[model samples]
Target: MNWLNLEHLLLDESPDRLLCQDPDLTLGQLRRQALCAAAGLQARGIRHLAIHLEDAGELAIALLAAWRAGVSVLLPADLQAETRERWNPQVDLWLSEQPGDTRLGQLYDAEPLPAARLDLDQCSLSLCTSGSSGEPKRIDKRLRQLDNEVRGLEQLWGAELGNACMIGSVAAQHIYGLLFRVLWPLCAGRQWVRRQLPFPEDLQRASLDYPAFAWVASPALLKRMGDNLDWPALSKVRRVFSSGGALPADAALSLQQRLGQWPCEIFGSSETGGIAWRQGETLWQAFAGVQLTQDAEGALQVCSPYLAPGHAEQTADAARFEADGRFELLGRLDRIVKLEEKRISLPSLEQALVNHAWISEARLGVVRENRAYLGALVVLSESGLHALRNLGRRALTETLRKHLSNHCEALALPRRWRLLRQLPLSDQGKLPQALVETLLAAPRGKAPEVLEHKVQDDGLQIELQVPPDLACFTGHFPRTPVLPGVTQVDWALELGQRLLELPPRFAGMEVLKFQQLVRPGDRLTLTLRFDAARSKLHFAYHNQHQAPCSSGRIVLQDSATETAHA
Candidate 1:
């Protein structure tokens, strides 16, 4: 229940024991490099450091160095500008691998400092959580809390894993990846892949090289594994750990059939750490020393050493405790909504949509306009695509909506629909709420495809083909498909600025006209001319027959100037 004695831990490990591969490093070498970097940070008087490194090896070194230097670490899940800006005040220095940034490699040649006792209670880490709205919420973590969880993991499965190395497809900035891929392995004296194995092919290759290894991954990656992969190489994997979200039953069974092992699914949030895990179609068993209970509303509440000290933390998930001390998760409690004074469950609506033979996946959300209305983003199955091609977008959408009416009230039916070939997922493999809202808010259409492109001295000329199935084409006409006039303006502005390097903020539009109808499948040539002196871009669209379709001038202001104007 105390902080890990990191100073002597790595120094006492076997000098030749493998820690990283591909420019391999041993435990002794890692400690020496980390100590050197710690000395450099001490020399620079960095007390609070923010780490943003992609390479796991480099990240591990920086983390250890900061710990050794008695400096608190800020581990941001993303390197987006907004995230960095929010944390800028709290951090004294940034440790990254970006060019021109302060990096650990700069201190590689510095004199190594003697191992110092680290006060685990004094060590701090800041992690960002992407809440339901996709905004980042900061969570402060103590090293002892993380150490307790890592020790619980080792006690649960460390014996069966033996000397198996660790490989992960997830970034270590997140809690799951940090514990399983970085901290757990280091504390257990197990080797881990130096870099993240982002792709399935990369995982297969690493499996072949390492005879035995534990795979740390997310449900998104697990669902993407198909029958085309090499099963033999996957069989060499000793264990598979999945987190980030719930794994579908079908995906779990598929992995079991192929890899001869069921992936251990971890159910927890960034705040709670690891609460429960399951290997197959059974109730989730709580981890050692973790207690689970239900609130008055049947929502799950967790009390564990892994969590911050206090009363049990209440979770959003509704669950029922089984007689065997395990729990079965019902859906999320927050997903239930009220529409037109009627209670409607978003997840239930999504389930109904997916249960229809045509829909492959569906997500339901309330879109706010003059009044709130339900919206659905759906991925069509093969049969659904055939239906869309045969019946058109309006008919297909109506059919799906009508199918949902069988089980739910009319008010609960989604009024707006966007059919996607595949749902948009973030790099972390989760559907970001902001992206979902953006997709629902934007006019549906296939992005224009470039048929031909030519760079001019001042601007560019390009020919594009507008596909018939573009979302913008839908509902414009029931029987005949025509591109929306507004979509044309959007395309012009988007392409003009993208290719011509126009100013970031839109100022106004001039001389805009929709003289001729642009139908789907029409080939149009777009010409853009930038007037930098006036901060304006002139654009014209003409059909293949040289008939003018549209022309406009868009004025923009530089981002800095626009900000000042606001």
Candidate 2:
């Protein structure tokens, strides 16, 4: 098989063919801009550069320019201040599109330069991976490896998707987004969107303009799409690809029902390029020229042209090969933990919880409390929320425990629980284990003081004294600290459920207004009224002088169906 240098491959394409949307630039224009940028970078004597631009179009141009300048490219996972700080000492220059930063747009006036002849072994690209423990792991790849994968992608899907423009909901920084949204399209001569389609509404609107387009997205964005979308407009979508995490079967089925096609799910990591893909319920099929085998520990091992030549990469995932040469993935071997001398699979437990009718998503982790205990963070389904509202936290927790008791061992059940509106995902669309542990950490300072309590027919009334060392007040504001609005609302509902008869699940809120700010050492009165007939909870916070601090009416639903209807 013949391989082409990155610059040559990009410049060899048709000059007048469209390569990007949003501003709509042709291949010839992109080549000229990249060549000019290459001249600018070469003039600066920058041999190593970090590329963290947000625009896909700018990123492609910058990448080609850096390659032409013989500058090694380091792709940081994010442009956050801390991430940049960590990578600053290693790179010679920082390139970004953010305001006030060093931008490629400045190089537009420079003279176009010749493309560099980069050796396959000499050209290096650095990619970052968030490892199992949430630490960043840097992986270096040769240009040849990327060339092999892009060629494989074109060979597999090029004919079916002939000339389809690429649109993505994922960022171009990560490996998946980098390949599907940027590299594959660049090599295949297909136009791609410059900006990421962050919302379902954006996808619907873009579908109208580009009738033949392929969407590269993640499971997180696809699963949360509400029913209020314009399904008819989405019918124009030719293909959809999902990666970054497991796509729930129900979510895939729902997308197929609305969009007339199932999303093809790709499974791989930063260290290993594209490994396998599957359309719907079928077993994962390895990509062309990719070979899969089991290691001594039964973990999946991949040997492919896409990887470093003559070496195999071991994956954390456990899998079993089917008779038909496909593979079925078991949970990650590293995610299994021991609890009270019993080995428990965290993924299995989470899958069981998600199987419950009331649970939409679940994440399980082991937290330290004298000894290690299981903790769960869950997003409730409509029915689950209804159960929470009517039964309270204790009842809802117990109900879930009871449901798990039928299938899971006693020690495997989660000891603590937190109900959230949605799972906290990092910018890369991954759940950071450290963030989950922080949610279960015990408060450091003294709890708030409850001065007075009274029971009413509709609700309850209480007086609370804000402690100077309240945990929520810490790091909330540096100079003039005031109680956060979210904290106030959370306290009202938590205290109401504990002291009075308030619902457990959060449904909806209306007329929420914050008039005055509460500070440390302030005495505030809280009033909560439950309207069972209307399924609404009215709450208000007032200062010692009876001036309103905040007020809201929260609506409760009996089932997810009811929530959807309302």
Candidate 3:
């Protein structure tokens, strides 16, 4: 496919394509700088160069120059010694404008420069996968794939993204960020914000700066924004797109509530780009020209001319088809398990638990001692705790049991329960399976001061300490080792349970708050009190310095009929 030249394609529009943050690079300046860079690289005989850069303007220029020169380019994942070593032997050049340009210059000084020859069908770029499961894999792309992708996005986004200022919180090194924020905007003549990585504050700032800003980010960024209690009331954001990880249904609703009613959530992977998008919780219609095919095993398969030909890629996610060519996201195929001779999806159970008023987050996993039994770790809110304490532990567990009984059988009610103020989520907004196992392995006797027992007429008090020797501190940070919030919340609940022993069970928790970081060597105090007759549990937490940290309420179950009911 012969395409328009990069310089002509971009410069033909107008001299004034206003990027929100960057005042330095105008359309004309960008084109000139890219041509110069391309000429320089070609003169140095750097045909196959790999880039590890963060500057949006610089990357755009470099990529455009490489395309114009018909030289191959690779965008590796954020640099590591190992990645450098792997690409070093294979790459003829390393193109970067960082401080260490001289280092690369010294490596390849002898080779003769090549003439600049632009071609449409040449290998354009390669993007590395996220490497969540293993080593990062490289996916090569022709100019055609990118041309089709940008065209598809331009059409699919319609007016929502049309002429909207693209603001991205994710790094440009990744596929999702590169395609939606950089390449699509470049090819489709859309203006974009220059910031490559944006924090919650930066995102809000970008929205305020560019009244027409549309955020393109991953679910991890979205969850972080929601979990950050101090986030400003966002008003200027036009729309937000989420991918990279599964967008939690609750998270989508929360974003819509926080940022004015904006359509959000685009569902896709790096392999297929954006396959479909969800406005709210309801329906997900496939993007234009994307076709869904069911495999022999009843699993969903995809075939789109946008993807490479002669290959059928299967996905682990299952979907329920609707009459209008839309689909509902069912939990992953691997998440389904047989519990008590009944099929159960752990994700479905986890979602149901979090739906409770008292519970802020929950995780359900099947444990096998002699036979498999449902296990749960729950984090409660302040109001949830009050309701649980008022009704008493017996009544609280009974209510929860009956609530879960609607979807799951009697045997599916979690036999073993550990109360927590928050559940651990990975950097990608996924629950860590390995961390769950570690929490479950804690011995019953030494459940720590956090998880023991406390009873008081006025209220109960508890203390939690992040021991420096804990194994988790190592992985959290090698040098500046600290306690992760995941472990902090776990200790908070263990202490909460010890302080307020109620009927051997509790309704759950409510309004549980995490105000700040609790690192190793920081001692935290948990204080609790309750209306015994009314079964109300009120609690407060303070650090070793007596600095007030967080406080909440718990609903306790009355002992009268707790176990018998369960």
Candidate 4:
């Protein structure tokens, strides 16, 4: 079947066309539901609606109805309670599956389901930014722009897709997933799963059910899927699409080896729709109608048909172009910082670090002491982890420094580095700058260098490294500085309340004991157990050698009012 343009998605499609996952569902039924909701929205005069639905089928009907009603829609990154409150002022009402919502069936009042072609130019959609650079902000687009993007995608991959089902791990609220997971299949007259697969195991099972399918994935998920599952289950897949960020070279290679083809890596953002794509190569070929150029400092400027007319985007990403009209991506140009009066490119440095065999993922952040310097948070590969376990911290740090020095000038090297199991990405799969800065600090009012944080059903166990540069150590006995007992107690309460949902206010402490001197670079383990019935927290700290350093039990209160009496 030829692609039915979104403008005529309802008008042109046959009544019996399959809509989605439900075998009995038909285009006619979906059209009637959308029309009823459209009538309801018009009756209420809803200008804007913020919506979150767990079922993508209902979500699709809602989107169609809202657009037909000429109501703009806001899609939050998640259905979290805080997300709703934060975005409350921007919308008139929320159409959600959460508690206290009216029946979705109630809106299906239009029985005959009036037929009409979409005036896509008038329809608008708003989605959240991916939350990588900072807090996720709202990015608005006309329905026509989205229509154009999907049409472009269809032109590129429709033949290869050939009626395959759409199934994915990514959320539909973000732009990448919205286009590839939902809109593309809907506009192209293809079927899609009503819900996203939560894990690779789920993907494996789902793939076996569909005759032909496509997998929309994230780099983080692909990296984590390494060799543990039944790879043969995905042999029938037609295509795999990756976005949100670059798929690292090694991870991409690993996937190619397992899946028999490299994923079609998409490069774009919420602001810039589909710009270019690459597969098994470093260079990205621009989309059919996208014009790419560079700024004075090499930042990429895009004239993509995906945007509104006259909206040429100047992105922060740096790029290098070849004579053949293909371009290679350098990292973000916006992360330039001045360290000791020397300008350092954090992205460039991070790229250098990630290319090393020792690191799988690298994020560079600023650390402030008396002066500001660069610090790093990295995920080590199997080989790097092996080296760390055998040669210890000093040797690992030294080897990393030697590798980094080969790519950058001496002034651009990171002063401190911490290896982690993974990157600190949000639910939207973005790295928040504020979160990065928090991870790089061991300041006066914060917990010391966190080596490990493990969460279990009843409690949390934290591993800490006492840094020599900790602000509290300045005067605590400059010559013979030891970790303050007060700081240790506070950290226990802090970590306990976060991971265990302990009472909010401090009551008192008991059985406090200090058995060891915790000096610079000392490793300590803090284990916390919460007794919910009594509102009591028991904390134990142990040195690296598994000997007791500090032990205590702290009382907690539900509120400040209760604490005052205590």
Candidate 5:
């Protein structure tokens, strides 16, 4: 992982090593394509290039090509309009794997240029992350810093990884995935998958092909997995690496029971690099050469080779030291609030609530009515939902109140409560504070509640809880209030566009049928699949007992044409 010798990767690597699973690609072929693209970048006089490709192998090639051309790389986290508008001006060119984008393809067919050995500082990278103000904050990293991180990771886990091919859901734009998925395994001569396995079924499928592969996962993907998956097929997974957020205790334990190993949860940020990690343990042990201490305000202070030389950073995260040199995180300093002259720790409250058998996970935050009061967002276990069904909402609330009352003072008790099947985490597995506040302020009865959402490559599956006072059910009553047929069609289109990237111009509907009436308080699972070639969105709604409620095809006009006469 030496910065001076990076050119060896492009020019001198073994020819037979594989880089992709589906295509069964070779390292040499990828390197040649990158070298040609680098030449094109040089010829075009592009200096700062922004890369937002989806394929992992293409992303790696773009990065190397940029570096080889002496062009700085800007790895955008996403391709949203706001993100593009903010970073677009800072970059000289934008690259993506969209249809009709012939820049890279044209370059790959051009005469190849010799790979250039980048200077330790020439191959720089920039990325934007959200700051406290909710605005994007730009962070630049030197090649030296990234190289040191890969080396440190190798020194620690090389023996265990042991030439295993890397595969899983984590993407390459994030720091953790950049290090573990692309750079570390590649530099260590281990084959890496070009596409992400974003589902448990995909993981098991890859395990059958490459029996010795490591998993690069996130909390969101792991949390969505069920016991129905073929877990035994993944028992040969060499290692499991997770980041972006803390892995739930229950998920870790369940995974261990299913796969016979606990995932290695990493603890760090984009600014500080990887600080420490743990294996289903309450405490985190710092990585090699990463010095840790507590500031006067209890914030964790870090000094490591991953940072700029002779630089130290103090993070807002509060930490408590253990006798064995391991540390326990006590959440952020800003998460503590004073209520009735007594301090309340939000994370501590969540931890205590999750300890109860009925509650699987809990998130506590502050919301204001007249004054600030705690709001509890709890993910119920089977027993908790059973109690809720039998005793009703009021009794369920009182039951949780009595359990939490034993652990915290009266001032710290949540005034507002909401139960959910899962936390609404983003694709990157992050639940920000702003989202927490929004969820707390959101009112019921306006729309159906989303209990669980899992996005796939083609489409997504959503579990919706139909509220008794659903706005669409206001007057759609035939003795009993039922969800309107029109409402079901609308929900499919809305969720399809938001989640599945389906086209927006509604042409018409085809083969629409309502098999059963969807009544109030019914739980429904909606599945949406977008067919790009035919411009159709297929949707199906099923009940809790897997009974079909409705199914249809939503025909959409193409981007350049509209069905004006439809």
Candidate 6:
């Protein structure tokens, strides 16, 4: 099951076949370069070498050369200086295409070196997780496991690849790109275009060179292609594959409409490798060797002998089975929300918001304690914003609030709404949760001033004042008498601090659920306790009932006062 053995078999048939983007290194020339690199490594007494390369044809050649030299290969995540410095291996020397330099890149022809035999069962390549949340960790795949992948892929698509050249956007250093662009092509006896397809320009260049090609790329790349480029119908392209992230339904349909064929969407992670592929609206058909089942929680569980043992990895993804024997992936099961004793799906909320005429994209997230507050960040289309500008900001917010209020209760309406210039799009158009938090951290415009009250030094006394004419009550529940929670809190806090110079800043309380709704006639008393050392203030609200209705702790700050004094 040695992958090299399969590669050798393929190479034997086309020693002169092209494997790189470079027109100079024809198939025969690349093989000769690999031999030379092998000899170079042997002469230097090197048994192990790590390759820091972009996804390209030279990288494949260098990898094959390392195998031919009987040297272990390490592929780092990126070529940061620190990454290069951390290349600790069993061997002391390194093999690179950068001749005078030590960096590993696509190879050029060199004199042939002695051939070193490889152990098919041994480790062949090392990959690292993306580590978006933590440090990247390395995972080693055996030559045999990789061989199984190439064999599986060849059996499924080898005939199509026979005449098509490999072309992909993802870097070969990652698992998806490596297997699709290198191993599969070599195993299938297919020629590969040698270069990482980076920009639209690069893809255009490749189209000029290789009329017939197979593109392997991520959903991010495809989404961007839809947004920015008007791609020609890929008449010469045999197939294209997409992976790395969820393929948006709209993006998939639009891409097919433009390209004349839909790219295959792959569902799997690095831990499990390729699992299944979905095209158009079809349910995902499992790859040839992969088996799928469900756990007790109804999550998709994959059992692959080729995967690392000790556990049958069950994914958080929800799925459904079709009578046709295919499986369809639903969204993640972890995205459920419970509010006001009613369970809600954020995705459903987002769908509802985006259904509005003005909104282009939307996401809803719960932020307050006990998930009491739900906030929305919306990206408005140009026409949407223009329409809103005519109504003014306050009118826009009020309009949206009233719109939601009509269908949902006051609590269900987003506590705060902002018109964002753009959606927090990832390299792909998908909104990441982390970026949502960043948007929420920005300062909201301002809370409108309601009423002011003054209290004495003891913090035990209070003064109550009402606005001569209430502006908030103008339309708020016109038929019913009600006070806005925001205005109510502002009035209560202003009056409680009059005499008690207990720090210019005070706390606000929202913990008490309003069991009985407060109306315009309700007289409310609010009290506070300030602890100097802790720089903390606690507030308690009292109305008709003796026991306080709500209490909360707030951290008080005087940075503005100190700055003024300075």
User: TM-score winner among the candidates?
Assistant: 5
Please report how far candidate 4 places residue 356 from its true position, in Å: 1.4
Worst 10 residues of 5 by lDDT: 1-10
Lowest lDDT block of 10, candidate 1: 1-10
The TM-score between candidate 5 and the true structure equals: 0.79
Clashing pairs in 2: 382-560, 383-560, 388-504, 389-504
The residue-by-residue lDDT of candidate 6 on 293-359, one tens digit each, is: 8877678888775476545767767788987769876656566667878766666566566656666
Instruction: Evaluate model 1: give its TM-score.
Output: 0.77
lDDT string for model 1 (96-200, tens) is 876666877886666878866666677788888865544678888888888888888988888878788899988888888888888888777788887777778
TM per prediction: 0.77, 0.77, 0.66, 0.78, 0.79, 0.63
Candidate 5 on 193-295: residue-level lDDT in tens?
7777777777767767875888888998888778767777778888888888878888888888888888999998888999999997999999999999888
**What pairs collide in candidate 4?**
none
Model 2 per-residue lDDT at 187: 72
| Cα shift from native, residue 110, model 5 (Å) | 5.0
lDDT of 1 at 483: 77
Backbone clash pairs for candidate 5 read: none
Point out the worst 10-residue segment of candidate 3 by lDDT. Answer: 104-113
Q: RMSD per prediction, one decimal? A: 8.4, 12.7, 13.4, 6.9, 7.3, 16.6
